[model samples]
Target: MAMIHDSIVKEDVVEHKLGFYPRIPADSIFTRENVTARTKLRAHLNTPLHLATMENKPNSIALLLSMGCRLSYNNLDMSAIDYAIYYKFPEAALAMVTHEQRAKEVMALRSDRHPCVTLALIAYMPRVFEAVQDKCITKANCKKDSKSFYIKYSFDALCPQLKMEDGNNVRRKSENVPKSQNIPLPALNIKYSFKFYQRSKLEVDALRLALNDPKYRPEPLCVINAMVAHGRVELLAHPLSQKYLQMKWHSYGKYFHLANLLFYCIFLIFVTVYTYLLMGSSENYSHTKKAAKCNLSDPMTFDRENKTEKNNVFNSDFESKVAMYTSTVAILAYNAICLIREAYNVKQQKWHYLVDPSNLVSWLLYISSTLMVIPTICNYFEEIQFSAASITVFLSWFELLLLLQRFDQVGIYVVMFLEILQTLIKVLMVFSILIIAFGMAFYILLSKVGPDETGHHLSFNSIPMSLMRTFAMMLGELDFVGTYVQPYYKSETDILLPFPMPTFFILGIFMVLMPILLMNLLIGLAVGDIESVRRNAQLKRLAMQVVLHTELERKLPAILLEKVDKDELIEYPNNKKCKLGFLDLILRKWFCNPFTDDAGLDLVLESSEDYITAELEKQKRKLRDISLVLEQQHTLVRLIVQKMEIKTEADDVDEGVSPGDTRVVPRWSSPRIRKKLRTASSFNK
Candidate 1:
């Protein structure tokens, strides 16, 4: 390598062809085709760039480039530029990148490489699951352009394995041995060693150069979608990625939808089960089994009358406690994940912290659960505890309803409900007036009639009571005795009143104005919204989904939401080692295990050194015997040819033809033949 520089300064011993190309003396035994062009510790297809890369010598790379070596040309496996990058030779890679332009002019291009966008998506996406055998699409092990990439370390032919045994890479029987350094991917248009295309400056600069060259600018959504799909969360550092990732909540639509849907199902299940435990199945109220009954079931049954209730086989109380313990733990764990996701949402879309309904529901749940903690721990105010409990149940179901907004079919139901509710707001003023007037009339009449026999007002003790009764009537709770008579009665005696307490007022005015007129009129007005909602289901659902998508996008980690250039992150994983498949795992466990899988080359290397002296002598002896046999054969052939030539000359004389007219074929001769003849003649004597 130093010879070029050495000769340049010392012209006395230097020679040149055409005053430019270097020339060697006649004594030089090696030529251009020789495997070793003054090399050591090298393999087949070895070149100066490969040496520079392996040695981590940047100066050597520059030297080789000056010597007219191409960095981006097709190397045996990896082009030099890709090899440098894979080996973490950044300086070498940069140097090659500079020379790439000139290389294109010299070498005929074959194919193109995948741009940053395509590779980022492909690299990060999870491998598709296959149930049975997959013949291709492997990260390692399987042969490449193969006759079997690499050979096993076994006793075999002495010189070397057949050349055909190895392909572009060595697929050694030991799958872990990484034989191929090749990155000649099909997606690239392979000009100037297209493998280096991934590191091209164009991709990440798309945003920077957007104004100058519109074509260079990728869509904000495209960068985001690619980043999400490829899992290059680190790219959030890019300004464009940061801007779009935070705002474009609906980016990565399908993947985002699926991810949230899965998490939502899990959250719903745990929340549902936990809510059940808190409401009824908890062992805290086991003694009050009658109190233990949830609202969904009949009132708890107390068996105090029985001197002792026998324990059942299942010990229902203890089992219920166990269920409570486990469900509580699971709920806590899942809730933590939910909170983290929601917090991430707030970070990505700052406005979502206040505007998103799901976020609002999550905050409500947090507050309610926090409020219930004291009541639950002290074992008092079961009503307060269950009120919070009720909130969780309502929120869980409501959250699911919001998720339904994303479903194209059932999404229309959400639209209809919201539309009807919004339209009903217009009638609220009229309804409020009627409710107030009716309540005031009832209060005046009932208080004027005085308390019933129980010494309490059943019809109207206050304006609040009158209002509550009137509102209940609107819901068709028309049993005035249940609503007004029972509460004030101390033995059904409170019914004693002038003209029958609440019945006359309920019949004459309350029932007529509340349920019969106002309540019916409210429904009649909102009923008009259903047809309008049904007609525009698609657009309405889309709007709802857009809203939902924005919220769900906030749940993702900001890292996943960020944009990274595909090229920068392809080799992001430093190890570059691929994980093994099921078959490989099994084979490794059972078959064979070696210290270091040198792809079988170690055996040849070791054996040649160990037996070098003896092996050379043995080969020489074999060659000598073959040479002697060849000399004897040549002697016989030479004698036969000479006799034929003499016969041809005599035939020419008999025919009276000129000697020049005769023709003779060539034959062989050797001094070794005469030496062998003499040795044989002396032996016969």
Candidate 2:
């Protein structure tokens, strides 16, 4: 059945591409004399509009709508706009809203019990969204329909149901009767039958399934990500949205997140201590041995016992091993916790889980830690083990810092650094080609140059080395005289000669292009966007807060969730009058966001103020438009009254009544009526 539906949709797409469904002429469908007939015809032809919408044919849908086709649901209880949004055809959905002032209807339509705004959010149609905002909720409306802000349903409640059909057979006859006259006919079943279940999985499986299933969780996440990606964080700042965020945060979100951060800190400490011990062991081993490189293949030189200083770290291997083992246990415990979290995200977020950079780092650390756990590998390959341990240590701490970024207090700084880092990467990408060109040029020019004064090989002797040297030069380490003054060996004469003029010229250009030009350009670019970076960083921080809180809500236990969830408007304190615990009071005093010292309530209030201002502006524009319409109507009315008076005067004069005589006038031409009309015209103006 699914395959059939897909094939039909595809065929419609092909026909649309081939122009088989061209726009119908309005004259053929509707009479020029009567609009009532057109309305009746359009009402009957709404099925075609629904069909066009289901097929995702935006042009056909628009054409049908232009002919006066109305938006309505078919027998399946799903409307055309619902089909468009459910299938994620943005053009098809936008066509409906952008035409014939149908945005209100589209916004009002409910798909799978969720407001059209919910699905429309995923579509990210600005015009469609704007239409919904036209009727912005005021204080009165918020009080009246406050319950509308909270959705009392599970995530799967938003998923559209698919209908399936199957043949049924095998009839068993059983007749119901009174207590004294019961009868039953039992026989052998002749055929088989099947039952179709709409939703077979448990409620717990809904989120997990939705992660990978397009019909479920992805739609919700898509709306969120779309807003964030487009820098539409202001949408998330809606009063209802902020209330939801606050509810989630004040519930188990803050506690769970803080606990998780604390655990990670402990893990980092363990990793740090483990790395310190390893480094200390290596350092002491280095000090104990003579300053001579030993061949790895020789067993005699590899003996550590023979060349040990009295205070070598290996002398206390017993105590060191004990400490290492203790730290390893703690690290492993934290790794287990991390593994559980990763598994949960994988099951509930699917591919979305991997989008986070920290997840990748955690996986890398996980693998490295697992390899390090094997005693044999660590003992036999000490160098490789140490290298892996070093990376693991760095990543563990870096991941902790990233986790800390979820907190708004510390997040701004991290966000600013990320913004700058991104700018730096772009700058480097643009200048990379120039740097490589210089590196290659230097390698070609100075490859034949002999060792420098101390008999050390010149920096530009090899291609890789030349690139490193060129990059270093860009950082103000120009060894210009040292590099250019080197001599090239003459093989035949067995003597050294100085470099030619071309080398000096190349050095001068390198100095100009790299250290002098590129360095300053990078610095200036990084500094120029500091203000914008700070502004964007705040928005990004809010977006992160939204994502974090939403995810926390999803992870909450359903039973406890109902208890924690707020279904009403959150009334924030106007001032800091409420008392707090000693620890919280201290923390709030020191760690609150500087820009919003009143505990995020100020930010919420600001958002609400913006919303109120926008609503007022919209109302003002509407009133102005209405006033213009009334002025036009008043003008038409005055013109009709003037024409009537002119005819009346001409008739009165033709009838030979004295010009001074006042005959009984009709109420329509009375002074009172004229005066009222004039007053209305003036008021409208």
Q: lDDT score, residue 369, model 1?
A: 53
TM match of model 1 to true structure? 0.40
What tens digits encode model 1's per-residue C-alpha lDDT throughout 1-685? 4584343223212212212223645334234322143332233545556656665655556656666665343435454544554565555544443342332211111112312212322243212101000111112244333432321111000001111123354221111111222221112111011112121233324333433443332232333344344544343222222222212322354345656776777766766765675666444356445444443243233343222344552476567557655655655666677778677767867884687455777778766655544453454546676787778778767877766656555557776876787677767655778777777766665554544323345656788888887667668876766645564453455543344555465567766777777777877866767876776663454344345434543444434534321211111111223554453343245422111123212321235566796688789978987998899899988899897864545454555656777666443246677788889999999
- Tell me, by TM-score, which candidate is best: 2
* Best by the lDDT measure: 2
Worst 10 residues of 2 by lDDT: 188-197
In the range 1-685, model 2's lDDT, one tens digit per residue, is 4564453444344434435455634333233332343334445344666767867777787777766665556555677876776677777776776565454445445544344344455345544443332223222223323433212111211122221112342111111111111111111100110000012223224434434442342222344455566776555554333433444455456667877777778878878888787777677567545433544566575565445533364457767767777887887777787789889989988988778666788899987876665553255436667777978877887787777677777777777777778899999998899889989877766666555422233676688998998889889887644444434433233222344577678778888888888889888887877778776775677688767756775676655654544323323133223445564554456555222224434443337678899899899979987998999899998899898864555455656667678677798898899999999999999
TM, every model = 0.40, 0.60
Q: Candidate 1 regions off by >4 Å?
A: 1-204, 208-255, 278-316, 347-358, 370-383, 447-459, 480-493, 496-513, 547-685
Give the distance in Å from residue 286's predicted Cα in candidate 2 to where it truly belongs.
Answer: 5.1
Report lDDT (CA) for all predictions: 0.46, 0.57
